[model samples]
Target: MSKYWSEAIQSLTPYVPGEQPKGSNIIKLNTNENPFPPSPMVLEAIHQFDTDRLRLYPDPDASALKLSLAEHFNVKANQVFVGNGSDEVLAHTFMAFFRQPQPLLMPDISYSFYDVYCNLYGIEAKHIPLQDNFCIVLDDYAQANGGIIFANPNAPTGRALTLEKIEALLQRNTETVVVVDEAYVDFGAQTAINLVDKYPNLLVIQTLSKSRSLAGMRVGFAIGSAELIEGLERVKNSFNSYPLDMLAQATAIAAIKDNDYFVETTQQIITMREWTNQQLQSLGFKIIPSKTNFVFASHRYIEAAELMGFLRTNQILVRHFSRPGINNHLRITIGTEAEMQAMIDCLKRHPDIISL
Candidate 1:
């Protein structure tokens, strides 16, 4: 609105994050965050970290953290790239490999941030629509483009594409980079990290926020060929040399090392998601087959916006997008058992909304 603003700033429509209400009684399922606490080892690491280290800059390379991720994922150290979060890593990826001659290809109903990054970097984008069941149709992506990126268990819909399909896309399109955003892969979907070694153009992005329960710490990384890793590093260093601070690096390293804790927590969320799906189905909601930490569902009779408002009035918050093709559905994050039971109780209280 101001003449002082740059052209890019003036034309930008920023991404809207889920609401973080300030209260203890509210059942918050709007944001897809882990409902469990971080591993005990992560807490121990945080306690052991020396506050005096704040005086010095963290290792510019984040060498220790990268090595941990490499060992955990069975990738070489040179093939790993760390950043402030997956969002920042993705931003650097757009600037590095996606700004090519052809427009970038992505799902029409994937993460909203993809479009935001495109606008910010002036990268033209070609949106490929998902199938009727909300699953990605790989055949639609067999075309010329600068690059390709989509969530494995796609956002809002919680539908996952098979690894065979992903590999087939990579096999057919070897010319452009393919970025698979696996932010929720730990929940149930198979990771594409294993194929990174086979395909030089494959880049798999992940975050510790969801399954690892470190959303507050803000840590994310990318695994790919050394060439792609180097490209991301160049963009990262040019933007900010110390993207990962001392505490964040330490916390993330600890989280990665505690494999058992990570598995237990993620498995619990997966189980809860299935139970929640069945419960919603019993109440006449058509729940999508979800492999992530959330479920996408729509009532047979009630409107999504109306149900969203009803839940909010009862101190239960879930996500509802006004976008086309999905405006009738609501995305509900899997909370603790008690919280979910409370939500069910709330639904029971409003029997009028549910079909017999």
Candidate 2:
């Protein structure tokens, strides 16, 4: 709160990321990160990267990485845009296509970052509420705005919308850009990348952090028509020419190329998520039908904050938001089998909490 601060900086409320506990004894399921290691190829690529290249700048366009992603997603090289992470890519997106006279349209219960980006860019936003079951109702978006954006398997809820519904929205609204954030699409949801070719107004954003297990490397990308890609490039180059460094470029390329390892790890998480959901349900929790790497559940009698505190005291951490309509729910990331068993054991030890 200093006079030296700019107007935007003074008015901003930045996004709050999940806690990263600093101990080996804690079962960390607060952040929805993959419990498995990144691809072996990614490790080898990092080890082989020449530290001598740090003196020079990385390729501004990230050409090699873009070409590799193009081949993998069946899109042309010109249609791909890479950035530091999906957050940066999304920041560039809000600046590029979403800053319009009409307010941007989004689901009320979608990713919290959408609102943050809107505020940072001075773009007005109109939040469309989700249905009673926490699923997005596409009809609400038919009225319109500057652009539309929502996570596929929506954040904190883990419920996914069908491709038919997404395509239907695109078909009806061809005037403005529609950005589909697919950060967790690899878990069990279908990707909108398949429809990017058919819908010129569609821009699909994805990250290697979740399913590919490269959160530390920080790489994400966007796939859209060449025109939209060029728009993102204009915003990116205007802000920072060299967002992706040499190591990040190499790591992303390797991670995208290893399709077998990616599939194996993603399937393992999905299996674990299902098993965890069943365990929670057996203890009188109402679990949402999740397609992402985490589960959203609410107990029949216990308060979510109390349950969250109880888990944390037992060295297990899950996420709980204080917002209305979902304050009673907990978002638990799917950890390893042993970590999950440990969490269940903690719950069993506190039967009073579950029976409250």
Candidate 1 lDDT (Cα, 0 to 1) = 0.93
lDDT of 1 by residue, 1-356 (tens): 88999978999999999999988889999999899999999999999988998999999999999999999999999999999989999999999999999999999998999999999999999999988889899899999899999999899899998999999999999999999999999989999999999999999999999999999999999999999999998898789999999999999999999999999999999999989998999887999999999999999888989889889999999999999999999999999999888887787677565436
Candidate 2 pairs with clashing backbones: none
Q: Tell me the tens digit of each residue's lDDT in model 2 across 1-356.
A: 88999878899999999998777888999999999999999999999999999899999999999999999999999999999999999999999999999999999998899999999999999999999899899889988589999999999899999999999999999999999999999999999998988899999999999999999988999999999999999999899999999999999999999999999999999999989988898887899999999999998888899889999999899999999999999999999999888987787777675454
- Quote the lDDT for 238 in model 1: 87
Give the whole-model CA lDDT for all candidates, comma-separated. Answer: 0.93, 0.93
Indicate the residue-level lDDT of 85 in model 1: 87
Model 2 lDDT-worst window of ten: 347-356
Question: What is candidate 1's CA lDDT for residue 141?
Answer: 92
lDDT for residue 306 in candidate 1, whole number 0-100? 87
